[model samples]
Target: MRPETKEITTESLGVLETAALLRELTAGLIASSDFDAALAQLARTSRDAIPGVSWCGVTVLRAGEPASVATSDVHRSDLDRLQYGADGPAMTAIRQREMILAEDLRRETRWPRWTRRALALGVHGVLSAPVDIDDQVIGSINLYSGRPGVLTASRQLTAMLLAEHAGLLLAAVRDRARQSELAGELDETLAGGEVIGQAIGVIMTQRRCSAQDALQVLRSASAALSLPLREVSERLVGSAARPRG
Candidate 1:
């Protein structure tokens, strides 16, 4: 479902200013090449754009199994550790794939394991919005406040909008990561081809055989060992390079 953006209210001039800033921030994030830098910018943008939020950060699904706080102004490492330990609201929102509001950590025992720790950190309240892409929950944007009830209805709406922007940026980062992996594979393939070709040349020269004969030798070695043709080629090349003295 699309985030509800109607609850955000401000003076007309303030609203106009915020809209311009949001546009600039979103554009900057979309253009950033570094994922961590982009996430940091997003957190900063949310904290600045939304009123009453003392801290803002993101928690992303790590390997599709657990949530890890990705970025934030608050005690990011501590919160991440709690989520990684499976004892925080970030994980709860990710597991449920829904919005969560903890109005007061001191009184809330819903996440008993995490509440005491958060209260100890002086975080009075928190609002977590799940970051989902195409129905798959990938992460969340958590806004923490030292003051309780800081995430009122209006602020929650603003936070959701910020989270939606973050979700899009995260999806783009994932796509880029996949593309980088494919590019690495392609480079490996090209390097393997070159190595195999040089090995074939070595075989042909050392044995005074034709190209077809050298290929047949490689194929025979592969078949005998049930190894790949490339592996056979590599071995042949290595043997030919050893000193005969």
Candidate 2:
């Protein structure tokens, strides 16, 4: 049978259910520290949160090429990899930016090789929901079931909702990580400035010279030692702390 592709509508989901999904996705973000962790959590969440989904995998465009980011179960990694480097539902969903469903892999005509192997792995049905990660990147949430007809329309709607929330949560996680990295850089810069200041103070006391002259001397020493100014400054500060025995 041919795979079904269509636009997802929210009419199948209730307000409280949607709210609960948002809460679950937010929890996934809070419980994660990086992109990979967040994606792994998302895969697990989708597998458990959506009814009839036995396995879940997340695939995203990395450097303009699709890469499998996470799978709900470690055993599903091989199954997910089967879709990569070949034409399959996940790629179709991502490329078309729509949901793709194969109600029965046995009768599925498209991607015969993939469906055949998927059946060997005990997957009888599949659902792929596209997620917009950012303006530049897109992804898909892939769900697999052990029996046919398990991936119903209502379940597809739920998976779609999960994908929407996951996109937002992942973007937040990425931004927060960027902010933390910048903060660490700022802290290092401030600490380095303090060391340079202390080194200049030591040079001023020893030679009775201006701060600018001390800095120039430090730079000259850095050149002679073939080391960075910051390293030279730290070494100078360390040596000045030792007693002149």
In model 1, residue pairs whose N, Cα or C atoms come closer than 3 Å (at least 3 residues apart or on different chains), thus clashing, are none
Off by over 4 Å in 1: 1-21, 64-67, 74-76, 82-85, 134-137, 184-193, 196-245
What ranges in model 2 sit over 4 Å off? 1-18, 31-33, 64-68, 82-85, 194-245
**Native RMSD of candidate 1 (Å):** 8.9
Residues 40-87 of candidate 2 have per-residue lDDT tens digits of 888887777766889998887755665756898776576556344157
Task: Report residue 150 deviation for candidate 2 (angstroms).
Answer: 0.5
Local accuracy by lDDT, each model: 0.69, 0.79
Task: Tell me how far the alpha carbon of residue 220 in candidate 2 is from the true structure, in angstroms, after superposition.
Answer: 25
lDDT score at residue 228, model 1, on the 0-100 scale: 69
